[model samples]
Target: MPPASHDGDRDDDDGGSFIDMESFYASSGVSFVMVLLTIASVLYINPYWRRVWFYYVRITITSCYYFVVDHLPVPVKYKVLELRV
Candidate 1:
């Protein structure tokens, strides 16, 4: 076999040099949901708005024993995307 390139040699066993995850991965199923929630939270909160509290209202909302079923619209999602680097 031919020699691997520098980048090729440094890749993970799966062959990704820097795995650009479409989403987070966790071992436990519940833990997996936590990862998804974290990513979702990052994508939901607006930056210019500046969070009102130390913790996001959504995270606290659950602690409040309230469950909101409806999803926010596209424009609201953009609010979070704007927070990106």
Candidate 2:
């Protein structure tokens, strides 16, 4: 039998080079879930880690409070003072 002639058209072959989007999304979702699960497990199993997380959260809240209090405009501060009184 004679060999088939080569052509530039690629319509016959399935798309092997392209990434499967469904599989990619499924794997990404699974990875995200796993990471969250791991974090939750660690926080649940370790009291020290949980305490550290809370400490950071407390510090963040305190810093934000100070920033807002110190940087408020004069009129806003007066209004707050009026509300306080």
Total clashes for model 2: 0
User: Between which residue pairs do clashes occur in model 2?
Assistant: none
C-alpha RMSD by candidate, in order: 17.9, 7.0
Question: What are the models' TM-scores?
Answer: 0.23, 0.52
CA lDDT, every prediction?
Answer: 0.58, 0.86
lDDT, candidate 2, residue 28? 99
Question: What does candidate 1's lDDT look like per residue over 1-85, in tens digits?
Answer: 9997666565447545375443234346668789989866775786534455435776788766543334424465456545556
Q: What is the lDDT of residue 22 in candidate 1?
A: 36
Give the TM-score comparing model 2 with the true structure, all chains together.
Answer: 0.52
C-alpha-based local distance difference test score of model 1? 0.58
The candidate that wins on TM-score is 2
- For candidate 2, give the lDDT of residue 67: 98
Question: How badly does each model clash, as a count of residue pairs?
Answer: 0, 0
